[model samples]
Target: LYGLLRRNFRIEEIQLVRPDINLLQKDDGTWNLPITSSDNGAGSSKEAMMLPFIADNVQIIDGNLTWAKVGETTSLSIQNFTIRLKIHSINSFPNMDLNLSVGEMDSTMISPIKDIKANLKTSEGLASLDNLSLNISGGSIEMKGDSTLPSKDKDAEYTATISVKNIDLETLISQFVPEAKELLKGVVDADITIKGQGFDAKADIKFSIPSLLVQDKIKIEQVKGNINYADFDFIISDITMNVFGGNVVGKGTGTLANISNPEFNLAFNVNNIDTGIALTALGQDALLAQGKLSGNINASGNISDIKADGKISSDKLNIKKMGDLTDITAPFRATITKQDKEVNIDNFSAKIYGGSVEGKANIIFGKDGQPHFSTTLNLSGLEAGNALKQLAGKAFLTGKTEGNIQLAGQGTDINTLTGSTDIIFKNGKLATHPIQNLLSVFIPALKTINFVAAKFLSTIGDGKVNITTATLENPQLLMYYGKGQMKLSNQKLAIPSHLLMRCDMVAKMPLVSGAFVREDENWCGIDFNILGTLSNPKSDLGDKLKGQAIGSAIEQIFGGDKDKEDKGGGGIGDLLEGIFK
Candidate 1:
C-alpha cells in the first residue's frame, strides 16, 4: 500500500508536515507545552505510509494551509487532528470595517507578542490609517480617522479655524512667584480672532489677575479696523484699561513699533462727571461742597503732543467750605504745556456781585515746582463800596462808589505780591446820611464850601465820574498813596483850595502810603511823605476858612472845642475841664 500510494498520487501535494510538540515542567508546578513545526518534513516516506490513513477521512483539502506561531515556526497541536491555515502577507487584510481579536489559545502559549499596528479597510466602504511618521517628540495623537469626505464649496456655510494650547499659564507663573496664589485671584480669559472681510480687527484683554491682586489691568494689543464701531478707525496697540470698583473703561494705547514698550493716548471727555460720586468713590467725606459740578470737561493729549481744555460750570457754586457767597460763577480756561508741565491761563474771568473782571495769567514753575504768576486784570463797573462791604463788612465803607479799575501783578506767593493800576471813580454822589453833614451851617463863608460841594456833586452825580486821574503804585495802597487831581466846577481854585473844598477829590488816604483817597465826593488829599502817584499833594485850608468870613477867626481858634460846646454849654465846660484836668 505504501509503494502503491507513492506511485499513484503526486507525492509533493500529498506530503504531511507536523510540528514538534514539547511539554516542560515549570517552577510553579505548571506545565508549558510548546508546539513548533519541524524544519524537515516527511516527504515521500511519510506520505507513502499514510495513504491508508488518508483514505479514512484524513484527506488533504483543496487549498494550501500554512500556519506558524507569531515569532516561531510552531504548529499548534490541539485535541485531535491539527489543521493549518495560511496567509500570504499582512497587506492581504483590507483596511476597512473589520472587527478581529488576537490572543493565545492556551495557557502554555505565554510568549509575549510585539505591537501589531495596522491600517483597517473593509468591504463595506470604510478606510482608516495610523501614520507613525508625523509624531512630535512628546506624546501626541497623530491619526486621521475621518469617516466623511470634505464638503463642497456650494454646501459650506461657515469655515472655522481653531487652535488650542494644553499648557497651563497660571501653573507656569506659579513657579516664579509662589505667593501668586494670594496675589492673583483670577484667571485669564480672552477671545481674540481675525475673521474674513469686515472682521479684520483683533482685541486681546486680561482681567482680574488674582495673583497680582489687580482687579482689571487690561491690555488690548491690537484690533483690526473692521471692528471699529463708532465711525472711528482706531489703530491702537498696548491699550490699557481702567477699572474703578466694577466699572471698566479703556484708557491708554500702545506703541505700534515695539509690542512690549507700549504708549498711552487716552482722552476722556465727560460732559457731566458726577464729582460728588467720584469723591465718594475716593473714600472722601461725602458732603456737597458745591451743589453739583455739571459742565463739560475735555482732556485730550498724548505724551508727545498733549493739550487739554476743560471747562467746569455749576448751577450754583457753594462757598460752604470757603465761608463766603452761597452762589457764584467761576469759569476759567487753562492751557498747560506737556513738555514742561507749565500751566498758563489764556483767560480766567468771573462775575462777582455787580462787577466783571477778566484776567490772563501764566504760572511759571520754578526748579522746585513752585508756581509764580504774572497776571493782568481789567475790571468793569465794580461797585467799590459794595465790594468792600462784602469783603470787610458794612462798617468799612461809608458810601457807595462806582468805578472801573485795571490791575497787574507778578508774584510767587500772596505775601510777596506787587502790582500797579489806575482806578477811576465816576458819577460820585455823596449821600448826606452821616454825622459830618451837620457841621456845614456855621459861617456864611461855609456857604462857599456848600456851593462848591453842590457843584462837584452836580457835575459828577448825574454825569460821568469827575475823576481826572487816580494812579496807584506797584503795590497798590487803596487809600494811602494813590493821588489825582480834579477840575472842580469849571473853576480853578488854588490847587490847595480846589483839593480842600471839593467833596470828591483824588488824594492819598491819610495814614496809608501809595494809596489814593476820594473823600465824600468833595475833597481829596495825598500823603505828605511820598509825592502822589500822579502828582504832588495839594490843599486849600486858608481859602476854605477865609470864605466862611464872619466867625472864621474865632472858629479857627476854638474849632476843636466848638463841637463839644455846641452839644451843651455846661457839658462843653465839663468836657473842657476834663481835658484840662
Candidate 2:
C-alpha cells in the first residue's frame, strides 16, 4: 500500500502492527505477499487475506472496515474503541450513520466535559444529530438538532432543542458568572429550543430551580418560569415562586438594546406571607418572628434608573419577640411610591400597643448613599403599660396618653436610626406596682424590700416629664404629695435631684415622712437622688431610704424599736450592740 501510494501521492507517517501478512495483488491473479507459496498456491482452496488501511492511534475492537467496488451499492461497517461508522454506499453521497464517544471534551468552553456521546445521521441531503448526551458538573444534558445543506443559490436553515435535568446551578453559574456564585445555588432543570432563519435566531426557554439562595441569605424554596427571546428583546412570564412560607407571582420584560443601559419593567404579587419567613427571605438580621403580609409592587427602569409603586397591609401582625418586647400585635398599612431617589409613604397608619397612630414619611438617599428620613406623627389614647411592655420587659405602668411628634434624621443602618422624640402624657397612674420602689431614692419603705403604694398620678413629657403635682395614697398604708422633673439627653435619663420631690409616707400610722422643696427655682431632694437609663439604671433604689424606713414591719421582722423591750435579744440586737460597743 505504501509503495503504490508513493508513486502517485506524497507520503507521510504510516505504521502497521501485523506486517507478517502484508500483501499486494494484481488484477490478472499475480501476487506480491509476505507469505509462503504453499499458503497462496494458484487454484488452491486458500483465499487472500484482507488488510486494514492503518492510521494514527486507532483501535479496532469488534468490526471490520470493508473495501468494495464504487457505484456498486456495496455496504461497509466499522467499529472500534473510540468510534463506529456505517456506510451503505459511496458513489456520490448515500446513507451514513455515525456515533462517537469521548471521555474528555470541552463543550461549553467552561470546563472539561466527561462521558460525552453523540449520534449523527446524514441521509438524502438532510443531516441531524440526536440524543447527544454529555456530563456537566454533577449533572447531565441532552441535545438534538437538524439542518439542511444549502443549494447553489440558497442559504442553510437550522433548529435545535436541549434539555437539562438535575444540573447544579452553582456549577453552571461559577463557570459563566463567578461573581454571583454565592447569590444563587441549587438544582436546575430546563427544556429549551432555538430556531433560526439564518441571521436572527429565536429561543424559547423554560426552567426551574429548587431551594435557591439569593441576596446573600434569602432563600426561595422553588421557582419556575419561561422566557421568549428574539434579537435584543426578551419577555418572561408565568413565573411562580415559594419563599419564606409565602407564594409569589411575577412577570417582566426587558431589552438588551444597550447592554450597559438596559431597560425593563417588573411586577410582583405576594399573598399570605408569613412574617417570620418573610424576614428571612428579605435577609433581615434583626428578626425572625411572627406576622402575615399581602401586597403588590411594580417597578420599571434600567440599571442606572428606576421607579416603583406598591401597597402593603396587615390587618393583624404579631411579633412573639423583639428584644425585650414579648407577644405583641399591631395592624398596619402603607401606600408607598418610589421614583429613583426616594421612597414616600402617602397614607400610613397602624394600631400599636392599644394606640391609634397616624403618620407620613419620606426616605431619601443622600449623596453618600446613606438613608435620610423625615416624618410627622400623632399618637392617641395610648396605654403606657402596653407601649412600654416590650421595651421595659414589664407592662407595670398603667396610663393613657396622647402626643404629637416630628422627626428628621439619618442613619447608617437599622440599629442606628437616630432622632429625637417629644411626647407629652397626661393622667397616667402607677398602681400597686413597686414602680415607686424603683424610686427608692425617694421612697422610705422599699428600703426593707417592702412595696407600699396604692395610687399615683402624673403628667409626663419625654425630655420634659415632670411630676408637677403628684398624689400617692393608701388609706390603710401610706400617703404623699410630690413634684419633680426628669431629663433626657443622648440615651440616658436623669431623675431630678433635691427638694423638687416630697413625700408623706403614712396613712393611719404617722411613722415616716420625707420632703423635697425648691429655693431660687433650684429643686433639692429632701431625701436622696435617683438616676438611671431606660434599659439600665445607676443609683441604688434602697440605699438612702434605709435610714428613714423604721416602720411597723421593721419592728415585726427585725425588731427595731421593739428591741427596746427585748432585753435579752440575741439574733440581731446583740450583734448591733456589739458593733456599737
lDDT per residue, candidate 1, 411-467, as tens digits?
A: 213233444444443433222311112122322232212111111111122112233
**What TM-score fits each model?**
0.36, 0.57
Q: Measure candidate 2: CA RMSD.
A: 15.3
Q: For candidate 1, what's the RMSD?
A: 24.1
Pairs that collide, model 2? 325-390, 498-524, 498-525, 499-516, 499-517, 499-524, 499-525
TM-score of 1: 0.36
lDDT of 2: 0.55
- Model 2 earns a TM-score of 0.57
260 Cα displacement, candidate 1 (Å)? 7.9
Q: Which prediction has the highest lDDT against the true structure?
A: 2
